[model samples]
Target: MADIAAASHMSLATVDRVLNRRKGVSSRTIERVLKAAVELGYLNPEAHEQLAAPRPPNIVFLLPMGTNPYLRLLGEKVRAVADAHSRDQPPIRCFFIDSFDAKALAAGIRQHARWADGIAFMGIDHPLVREAIEEVGASGTRLVTIVSDLPHPARETYIGLDNQVAGRTAAYLLGRFCGGRKGSVALVAGSRTYRAHSERETGFLSLIEELQPGIEVIGMREGHDDRNENYQHALALIEQHPDLVGIYNVGGSSDGIARALTQKQKSGDIVFIGHGLTHDTRRLLIEGTMDAVINSDPDQVISATLAHFNGVAQASTRNHHLQHLKIELILRENIPLQYV
Candidate 1:
């Protein structure tokens, strides 16, 4: 290995990684190492040729079946990645599963475990799902949690924003937007089964209590990330709390809440803050209905996931250095330009 490393003008560890087919070494580096090995008589010429061109690993993306605009955008981005790499890489499959059902989600994980070299999914915090992830990971498949996370040690890494910080940021923004108003605030969540949503809710409430003691949190309701359900919940909150001055959505389906606010003629009256940047959220921000949108770029999420599978050194850390994306706060005046 030392001789090959010297010949290749690379480090001994890098040469070892390439020779052992381990991750964190790029294809170009592998080729260079193999070429050096062939020249040094450490590897056969024919074997070197074969090792220089390795087959791309198959990756499966499991997204939730939902109407959430952000999730829908993620699905589209995943599909686009699959389509773009169809010719050079192994077939990439993206499946929409009932993430709310633990059994169904576990089954989906197990079903794809047979052929996937790596599996990325929006995780649900369920025992069955964790078992499936552990089982697949035990079989030498890489497991990644995206968007939402499972608090299990079996997964390789989580690729998303820090939900707790996102929630706290929302709370701070809502409190500030309300201008220290003495009124009640309401919270709407997608579902507590998703660790991301639950964490966001926890963070939001904790910060609200500490930072704005005067503002009362009326209560929290589950919207299931459904537009109609969120709409109904928002409407009910409006009726119940005539002194409502703010609302924090810990999950997606911001459009439904916007609709309810508009119907109640409380569009800009209530300080509304939610997660995810989508077409509807963009419109809401532009129209002055939403005070702020907390978001993580879908492109960054996808790139980080792919980088892990591709054996990029930066993404190989288990501490989620590369996978933990920055949180973006989008307001009406500072909304980013939309691309085609």
Candidate 2:
């Protein structure tokens, strides 16, 4: 029981209160804790004593495959929760789908729909994908979305950073650090098809236009969150525009941007501000290869997602609850240590 509480990262008081049905518990927070406990089978032994009774509800967590490091981190957290609960009897079964491939992602989601008491998936403001997500939620199972979310036809509250705010933050840091120099800025991002990166780029360019009108935002490359592809683009951009003052990598491509920057002749002269503090980003922050990194904790995002999921389940919140986006600005002085 304590293990479940610890892995869920909730306080012992809260966990105890929920398990005991204590008075004065907020329905939303209670639901979150109960969901975690039920998913983990914390009451499995008691249930085994009564074979005729119905078992606990099973929730299915559908996540993207770990094609990127960020997704891997996400999977690790989910696995930790699942592992803690299934000590004897298997707990909630987790399903994985790759968001990069449209067909596979949709198919995996459809296949897992039948067994799920709850659903959590990512969908942006697209037409067909959005429609599919909406239809699935109508199946009477709780739905949760991670990363980018469809604001209008929402599917449970999204639990991730505000991509646009992150973009604007990146621009602000880069512009200020560049000392108002009128040089080009490279915008490396994930796939343009990914709504999160697209929104970030939009916000970043808007800020660049308003704040540093003189700084030419060049080298807009869809690095596809591929480090090598990012490096290739960065190298090409530098070759084309030797006077690049800063690089604004608004997604996973930041590592590649840092690598490219390291190879340049005037490496220290240029500045870099990117999003997310992956392992590579953390190293770069310490080494001063990157100027600033706008990041969010994946574990925190997962916790928030669970809280929002419970909130919606209890009718206390909407699917697209405007939870405050966390933006951590990392520098050499205040680099965050990665916790596994």
Q: Tell me, by lDDT, which candidate is best.
A: 1
Strongest candidate by TM-score: 1
Report lDDT (Cα) of residue 293, candidate 2.
75
Tens digit per residue, CA lDDT, model 1, 22-47: 54467889998998999889999777
Global lDDT for candidate 1?
0.85
Model 1 earns a TM-score of 0.82
lDDT of each: 0.85, 0.68
Model 2: residues >4 Å from true position, as ranges?
1-57, 86-96, 152-154, 314-320, 338-340
- Note the residue pairs that clash in candidate 1: none
Model 2 collision count: 0
For every model shown, the clashing-pair count is: 0, 0
Which pairs, if any, clash in model 2? Answer: none
